[model samples]
Target: MADSPGSGAAFPSQSPRTKKYSLTEEKIFYMNCRAAYLTVFKSSLENIISKDQLYLVLQHAGRNPSQKTINKYWTSQTAKLNFDDFCVILRKEKPTSKADLLKSFRQLDVNDDGSILHTDLYKFLTKRGEKMTREEVNAIINLPDVNADGKFDYIKFCKLYMTTNEQCLKTILGKLEVDSKLKCQQFGSHIEGTLERDPSPVPKPSPRVIRKTNQEMFSNKGGSRSPLLSSTRNFKTSVSLTITMSANSNQNPKLTEPNLIEDWQCVQSKGCFFLEEDGKIISHQYRMHIPEKSMVYLTIKPLKLSQVEGKPSPWLSVDTALYILVENESQANLQPLCFTELQNREVFGWTGELGPGIYWLIPSTTGCRLKKERKPVPEEALLVYRDETGKLFLTKEFRSALSDIFEVIDLDGNGLLSLEEYNFFELRASGEKCDEDAWAVCRENFDTKKNELTRQGFMELNMMEASDQGGDPRDLWVILHSMGYNKALELTEACPFVINIHAEKCKPRIKAVCMEACNGQLEKTICKYVLTNGSAKSMDGYENIIIYTYKHDSWITSVIENKLDNKLIIHVNNELSKNCVNNKGLNTYVVEVAPKSTMVCQHVMPLNERQEWIYHFLSSIKWT
Candidate 1:
């Protein structure tokens, strides 16, 4: 016999005990090889084999076997070999499956403490070309470390590697499935074309109603039907239904076509165009319906060259300039509201408030410059409103009156009306009678505790009420009067002026003014300063001083100084002013002294028991 590779080595003569031990060792080797292959590859003993499976088995067995050797045995003419044959060729003598995993974990653990530290994990990953920041490494370590000790035990380390391998396999399989679907779709289309060319009529097969589970629907299946195929069938059906419904709908057929406008003809004259009673162009190209005077929504279709020339013409490009012409009834003149170049858009909409009257909507390609020439397009333009009137006729008057009233009562100068301010305005409107029901409604809608009423809110409320009453100005007036705006002008004129100052400057001034106004009974009265800035610090050391400059252009500063001086005439004297003075070359600080009020710092501070006295004194001062 030829000498084998291990045949030349010296060996002891066979004995009965040695023979039994050798048999036992062979059995143990076979068992370990099977376990390692099954655990690593996750395959059964009867499954077909490939070179990739052999590689994984060898890798799991901690053996660096040659790829050529694996291929020569696994890749045979049979195309698929069983697990037993794979083991026979690869040599069924291997270490335990978990030994390799344990070796890898030990390499990462480094300290031989049974647990891998975050630093060790980071170093291991870096060695494997995974560049990670310290934070990222820490985050990954914390994931498997349930105790959050920033280390991974043997079990966790194994689990992490297993999960990573599964995720990587799933990702690769997903890409392969996507590529297969694209190829299948292309093939399916080609097959359908060939079937369609057949002379004989073919019977259609009934669709199979397969109820797929979530896993099946989302899995990588090369043979099963893809979601894309089903979605495409559904999309085709929906398109067909849409076409059938659109054909029966009332919308102009031409509007359904891209970049096409409806062709309209003059009803009364050969050349002159006019809007129909239903607010549509003579060709039904443009349409709008005004339900109220305040606003209207207009829809315009793209105009064609033929529609503009009143004759046979080539189709115009979708990118054409379009202009809106508004004929104001009050002015008896046409004016351009807005204009834009049309693109491949579904519909051009115009929504805004317009004055009451018969307004004609003329679409022109020449922009607003066409309106100046008083020339009309050959195609009749649409009428936006015919004999329509705005319900809120006194919109300007109402807004102006309310704005003035709000300004008078907005003592904090925060641009919003507070509940207390609203209440005071109500008192003036109702001759000092409180309307609790109206107040409750206002509070519910405005949520005065959370937010104040803005100007936009007031205008929107007015418009809503006007719309509800069929655009009647009288109804709006009634609503305003009910809210205490009937005597707004009278109340505004009689209202005392309120000054706005930094709370830091005004706190002591308020105390001094109260003491002076109440005949030195400051301790008996409760004085509170409403701090608009919402600062948490007390203004004890801070002094309220007005700086005056000789520069005449300082009109704003001078005006404020004059008001502060007039208000503090009773509290500030020449001697006290001299003590707290900071006079520069041109600027002088006029300091006014007063006692500080002991109260909680808040946005809204109220003076109890002496509300009228404080209001009178504060409102007497003027704000620039």
Candidate 2:
């Protein structure tokens, strides 16, 4: 893998990346649609709007505005405005009676608490003045939105009443269903859509890294300079995380496969052969798709002639050479990164970690020369691994897993997953959501029906994913595992993964840690990363689970022991923490632990690279 004697030059320097790509116009339109939300709010919403905050938001959002532009609007640093005040600043006319109505309600808020208790309001409306009925008072309370504390903001209630409760009711109704009738309505998509316009802040699937070939370094196969592979499945030693699917998926009790699931082709993940027969080499170039931030390892395992029954060996006893080809995003430019030969070790090749973007891996004998064979060689098999996963695409096991996923996300029991339904799945993975523009991309690329992703289309999409990631299922596992699917791919009722944070620093925060689990994709991902074969309805059945959080300088370690035998999946969410020190990293974990086994599900060092480590555990996982 060194400058192949054939490579007249050193490996070329990779092109430097300077800026993020611009977003599509459709995503921009989706983002701008958020303005429509303020329209009813033209009647009404997040934090206080300050010039500094607005400038940061717009700049990060890709507007790249000058301080002058923001200054024109913000005017002064001391000037601050709430949502309603900001609306007035926008010059939208306020309803004439709204202010008077709010003032009148404020008179009833004796505590100046900005809200009136439902009971107090009910007394005022029914016990005095215009003398309204209990029913009428209850009806009005439903308009604005009441806090769980049993109070509603009088001003907000007054504004909603003026705008007509219909708008409030529409928003509330949309929250109640998954596939709402509201055209393209999505929470937080508008703001995020603009951020994606820069593509820098957000990470889509990435291209991955590059590793200098193993030759220049120490070889694994002892004296063999770069023996391709030494499988006792060599990767198991290098991989800290191993993703395996249950082979006996059909027997799993909790996973219900769709009765009407459709079939599609399983895209093959491996390419290349070096078999030599009748004094000639039998080989052709193989194409591989590499996704973002992925590591690709090319390994060829030697198979003895007797081990493979009738299979012939590669013509490798003599020297042979192979070239690795890569193409740019548009497939417009084809280039060779490096070449591998049967140098000291006939079977060895190279490993590399690449960047973000779509690229192809081509291993061919076409461009390289092969030494004349003196004698035949043993059979050889080529294996490709992306990160820690190398599971083949479209196996019976994968199909079973994906079919269950389609069923869970379909939401309405419909065979097709709508844009909303699919975005729900997207959100499950990587905590990012997409809109019609993305859905349009899916529809254009895959086979679809009725403008939604059919089961077949969904399966095809995953196949492309498998192809892109070099057969790594880490991304898919993260979504499913977080959803409550144990290692056996069973969705436990509601058992949650636990988090143990060990920190020595006082006031060390764990910020933005959000965890949720249901029959959804995102939760499935958090749990998916760490799981084993275990199935139980809930964590209530397991006594071994323990939760520990660190904020103050004191260290609290609680390692509870379990006595239960039931297998289960669990997601302990950090997002729902009532109040604690500030935090970073919004993460959801679905963990599976088995009876009598003490497994440290996940060990994450803080991005700050301090000594802080977050530990997660899985409930149980089943492997066939």
Off by over 4 Å in 1: 1-394, 432-440, 446-449, 461-496, 500-624
**In candidate 1, what are the lDDT values of residues 65-161, reduced to their tens digit?**
5554565455344465544444444442233345577876787666777787766677876565536667866665767443247677865656655
Instruction: Give the Cα lDDT of each candidate.
Output: 0.32, 0.37
Q: What count of clashes does model 1 give?
A: 2
Candidate 1 Cα deviation (angstroms), residue 265 = 74
> lDDT of candidate 2 vs native?
0.37
**lDDT of candidate 2 over 26-53, digit per residue (tens):** 3343333333333322211243357766
**Which pairs of residues collide in model 1?**
264-283, 391-471
lDDT of 1 at 124: 72
Per-candidate RMSD, Å: 41.4, 29.5
